[model samples]
Structures are given as structure tokens and as C-alpha cells.
Target: MKNIIILCFVCLVTISDTNSSSDGKEKCEGIYVRDKFHKKVVIGMGLNRPYQLAYDHHNHKIFFSYNIGKDDEDSFQIGFLEKGHIKHKVLKEVENGFAIAINNNDNVVYFGGSDGIYKQHLKSNDSVIEKILSHQNIWDMFFKHHLYFIAYPSQKLYKYEHRQNKTIPEHQKIIHEKIFQFAIDGDEDKFFTNETGLYRIKNSTDHRIFYEGPKVYRAIEIDNKGVPHFSGQNGIFVVNKKNDTLEKIAHVKNIFGLAFDNDNNIVYSDPHEIVKLLPEDC
Candidate 1:
């Protein structure tokens, strides 16, 4: 009887494993309420490791950077999903790379890889790789009013003016001197970074601690209203520039990427899913 009981337990374990794997294989479809707590919209396949996500309002397409395998060795591709169809084009074939941004025109995509910064033009069907200032790894990039902002793990901020075509040092005033991620305000006057703490830079002013918390991954200015919203390990927090109030919007395990659609829909990526959260009334 003891052996029979043991055999039954073994069988149960096997069945459970099978079910878990099956669930992982099943593509999550439609919108789901995360743990039944908040509404979520899922897009694309179950991504094993998604590096970044960007939305192209011009084409109504969502782009995803996916890395495959243990050291990210197997595959690295930039894919787009639109109108229920998914298509991908290889940007890199190596492991451990980063995608910075997709140009508003959807004609150029910039990414940082183990080698260096790469620019790919969709129209010309060509790619150019250039070495940026640091090899420590670039985390993100944002373009505002012809100025390009590059964030690096070294906590340094660099800006490149399109007209001048040169990298300028913009780190002398940053508080922590170590920046993890950042976002530029639409107006080009203010920008926020996630370093040892939340820091904001404007008009050459040095780092000013705005909020203190775990490392932040991404930030976005909502509605061109100057209210800065950021995503970190603790969840999403919003800072009201006018009132100087910081408040939590929602909570998730980890946010890897963030983008706001034209309709004010907040789209972000958590571990295995891409979620879109609309305001309660909407």
C-alpha cells in the first residue's frame, strides 16, 4: 500500500508539471484582470525575455524586443504586432542586447548590443553600428526637440544634438551620478531619471531628488501636463509638478517597459504579459 501511495504521488506530480507547461504554452488572449485585481490587456506571444517595448502611433503598431535562451544566446529579434498579425525581423543574433527606441517615423530603429549602438533604417533596408561613449551598456534612449538622451548604467547622462551631431556631457549636475533609466518631458524642458533615487534635470540644474525608492526602469510625462509618471519595483508612481505630490497609480511585480497610447491608455510590460490599463471611467 505504501508503494502504491508513492506511485500515486509521483503520477500527481507529473500531471501537475504537464499542466503548468501547457499553461505556459497557451497564448494569453484578450484582456484579463491581473489576479482579478485590475484590468489588463495582453498582446503578443508569451515572451520569455522581452527587453523593451515601444508603440508607433503613426502606424498603429506595437514593437517588442525579445531575447531567447539562458544568456540570451538563441535569438534576438524586433517584432511588431498589428491588427492581430505578428511579424518579426532580426535586429541582432547575439545574446544580451538592448533596444532603445523606434523613431516616430517608423523608418529607423536604434538599439545597443554587446558591440555598440546600431541604427537600422526601415526604408533603406540598411543598418549602421557606431560605438557610443560607454561600453558599460546603454539602458534607454529618448529624442526630444532634436536632442538625443542616452542613459547608461554608469549613472551618466549624455545628450547629442542633431544639428551639431556630437555627444555633449550633461552629467555634471546629476545627484546620484548613476542613472538607471529616464524619460524626457514632451516639452523638452524637464527630464526624470531613476538612479539611487528619483532625479529630475531641467535647464542644466543638477540632480534633484524627486522621489526615493527602488531602481526605476522607465518614466513618461502624461498629457503634456508636466505630471511625470515612473515605473519601478514598487509599482507605478506619479509626480504632480504643479503641486509636487507623488502618488501611486497601480502596482505590479516588475515593469520592463512603458508607453502611453493616443487614447491615454497606459501600456506596460510585466514579466510575461503586455498590459494596457485604461482609466476607471474609460
Candidate 2:
């Protein structure tokens, strides 16, 4: 999934790498608002192709994977924000470092690249990159009870169990289509999204469509209380847990990655900067 063009759920729109203004501020375009309002703020700047944000609740930092330069000159690196500064220490650059995950319980951050999956202890003073899985191309991944990922080209879901040290196909049921990204709610309810819509797997037997909006949602994230947020071309949308309704929260253009900080604020990326969407009242 190199240089893949992601589409929105409601309509078709394409995103570019640069959309800054003449005065050096990034211009947010194609905004479509709804009932709720959120103030968008740029938390970090000067990045290239930042994708897939994972938040560390313990340290309250956002870790992301990005590429410098383009095409043949591309170099992959992992970055994290510190004290509102773009401070990043490259753990170890790998081939196509596109996926990133952080385990708060183990205090470890995992990086998935074309070569394999590598992990580094976050709280250690002398952290070193250690290869956990090799020779597998990982496109997008996340850490729950285990590592859940969508392997590129095939686009099927696989689970990597750390305790057993095994990678196996999701044996509960068979997914017929390609899956993009997935998230588990606070209740440990598993949900996934594909070309059609978002689906929930209940009791490992019932696979049903949860939401049918956005034909091609790129990123899906859940907050601390199990509320789900989706990102596409239009903006960020949230599924309300109390009333079971979908509402547009923020209208961000070309939003790449989706994440929720410890405070439940939305953190996402555009082309060249990382943005945060916070509630206006908060």
C-alpha cells in the first residue's frame, strides 16, 4: 500500500502532500461542518507524509511513522512529540516503516516495516531496536491483547500472539474483503473497517455491520470510554455511545491519521503538520 490514495466515506476526494498557505500557515480546505464544533490547532509542524498516530497514555505523547523525501529518495523514520516540540529520536529505520503501535502495559513501542516488526522499550535509558517478526510486510497494525494487522497485498487480517510467539490467521471467522484498520473498544469489543463499512465481531460468531457511513475510511480510533472516531476526506466523525448516533465533530481537510490522547482530544495529521482537534468548550 505504498503511496495509496485514500477516499472518503460519503464522497470521493484526493489528498496531496502539501497544502500550506503563502504566509506559512497550513490552510484547511474542503470543510463540511455539522451540529457540533471543534477548534483545530496545530500542535507540531514541519513533517513529511506523517501517517498512523499511536498515543502513549502513560507519557502522554503521540508516536507516528513518516517518510522523508519522496519516491526513490524516501527514508522512513519514527517520530514522537515531546513538550509540544517535534522531538524525535529514530529508534531504527527499517524498510517502509509504515505501522506503529505502543503498549502501555509493557512500556514498549513497536514499529512494523516491510522487513518485519521491531520493538523498543520506551522507558529504558538504553533502548535498542529488537526484531520480533521478520520477512513479513506489515501495512497497518495495532496492539490490543495481541498484535492485529492487515498484511499488504493480500489485505487479510492476522493476529500475532506475543505469549505464544505465533502469528495466525483470525481463526474465529473468515473475512472475505480487505480490511484497512481496526480498533477495540474499552469493553474489548473488536471492530474493523473495509471498503464497504465498519463491522463488529461479537462472541467470535456474529459479524455484523456497525456503521455504514464513509465508503473508504482510512483511520478509525476509539477513546478511553469506548467512543469511536473515524477519519476521511470530509473530516472527523464520532459515533455517540449514549444515543447511538453519528455526528461530525471537526471538519479537517486531508486528515491522514486518527488518534485520541489521554485527555480524549483528537490528534491527527495532514500533509506537513500534526493537528489537534479539541472541544471548543474544553
Candidate 3:
């Protein structure tokens, strides 16, 4: 039954985590990526293209998608950074994937591909279930607040509420339009980016515009302070609601993915080079 599958999935991940540790330290401890922000750290020179990043705090893993806009069979790959370095053999090759997210609770990776969104077991490197929901060709997704919100090119939104049967959770069309990238803080307030501008969704329903300009925002991430920060074609900017202006934070260009680390450090990428923003630098 579904309950038994859930139990086995959890146990396997836990055992894998336990076995991957050494000297009372996580296998990833001391093997973090060196900062490559705004610099020419071309980790993507060998790949086709990369986009979307998901950091799994529970297992100290980084999941990402590459080879965007390619055919489902040969265009995309689901990759990860583990044991303090890039590990190509960890996860199986995926097709038509544009974005990815990690369920830290279950040690699984949910990815959007040409067909639809699928959840895969990290420990076994096997696709756990076929097709989590509808909306073919998922462009992006986020696993936050116990819900999986995904977007499509046609401006459709789909979400799956947290449940034991995540592989087959009932999908809901909650948001009527599309969101390029999104981030949610502890307050459940979501900051999103679209073709028009940067926006905010508060109280789970009330939507408001944050910034509207010529800049095409690419990444949306919230810091520990409840304020939202964005990266885009120009550079990185943080919300300064008091002045109704976006405070420029970093001058990097073309940030394709963004997230806040456990220590509130910013982790982002140019869709090629992944970097961590340290407190001293930011």
C-alpha cells in the first residue's frame, strides 16, 4: 500500500544518510563549493545548459537541471552535487527536465520534464512514481510550505499539497497564471518573478506588484529577514519596501537560480557556475 511505500522510502533514506557520514561529520561537511559569484567559474562549459537549483539541507545535496530546451530523450539531465563536489553518477539521466526540487523530508527529487512532473527516490536513484500531476512541460517548481507549486509556459499553475502519497497527490490549479521563479519565507508569503515584473503573494490570496520595469527578473529568493531578493538580467536587488525601491545588492548578471542557505547565505548560479554569497561579501 501507499503507507508501506512511504515507510520504506523514509527508512532507506535515513540509512543512506547514516552510512554516508564519517568522523561524526556529514560527508559534505568541509567539501562545500568554493564561491564563484560574478566570476568566471565555468562549471557549465562541458554541459549543454543549466537552470534551477534545489538545496537539500537534510542530506547536504544540490539538485539541478541542465540542457534546457532540448528533446526529452537527449536534451536534459538531472544532476547533483554531493560529497563536497559534483557527482555525476549519483542520479540517473533524465530527459526534458527544466527545473527540480527536493523533498527533504522523504529524500526525493521532484523534477519537471517534457511529459510532466515526476518524483524520484534519491537513495535508490529510481523514479518513485510516474507523473505527479498535469500541465505538461513544467518550467519551474518549488517545494515549500508543504506544497509543490509548478508553472507552465502557457501561464498555468499547479500545486500538490503535502500527503503520504505524494506521487499521486490531488493536483490543484490554485494560481491562474505563470511564475518564472518563486521563493517563500517562513511567513508563507511568496515572492515571484514573471515577464512583466516582480510580484508578491501574501495572505495566500492577496496578490500585489512589487517591481515593474524593463528588467526581466530570473531568480526570486527570500532571506531570513522576511524581505525578498531578486536576480535578473541586470543584477541582484533586494526589496526595500520602506522606500518603494529595489536596493541593488550584487552586480552579478544573469542569475538563473537562487536560494537561502541554513545560515542565510545566498546560493545562486549563472545557470552554469554555482556560487554562495557570504555575509562578509554581501
Error of 3 at 247 (Å): 1.8
lDDT by residue (tens digit), candidate 2, 12-98:
322332555456544554332353346768877888867888888877778888877675675677777864666555545566788
Best by lDDT: 2
What TM-score, to 2 decimals, does candidate 1 have?
Answer: 0.66
Q: Give lDDT per model, in order.
A: 0.56, 0.72, 0.61
CA error at residue 3 for candidate 3, angstroms: 87
What RMSD, rounded to one decimal, does every model reach?
A: 9.4, 11.8, 18.2
Worst window of 10 by summed lDDT in candidate 3: 28-37
Which run of 10 residues does model 1 get worst, by summed lDDT?
A: 27-36
Residues forming the 10-long window of minimal summed lDDT in candidate 2 = 8-17
Prediction 3 global C-alpha lDDT: 0.61
Where does candidate 1 stray beyond 4 Å? 1-38, 71-77, 86-90, 93-96, 105-108, 121-136, 147-153, 162-176, 187-189, 213-227, 279-282
Rank by lDDT (best first):
2, 3, 1
Best-to-worst ranking by TM-score: 2, 3, 1
Local error of candidate 1 at residue 137 (angstroms)? 4.0
Off by over 4 Å in 3: 1-45, 68-74, 87-90, 121-131, 162-175, 204-207, 223-227, 279-282
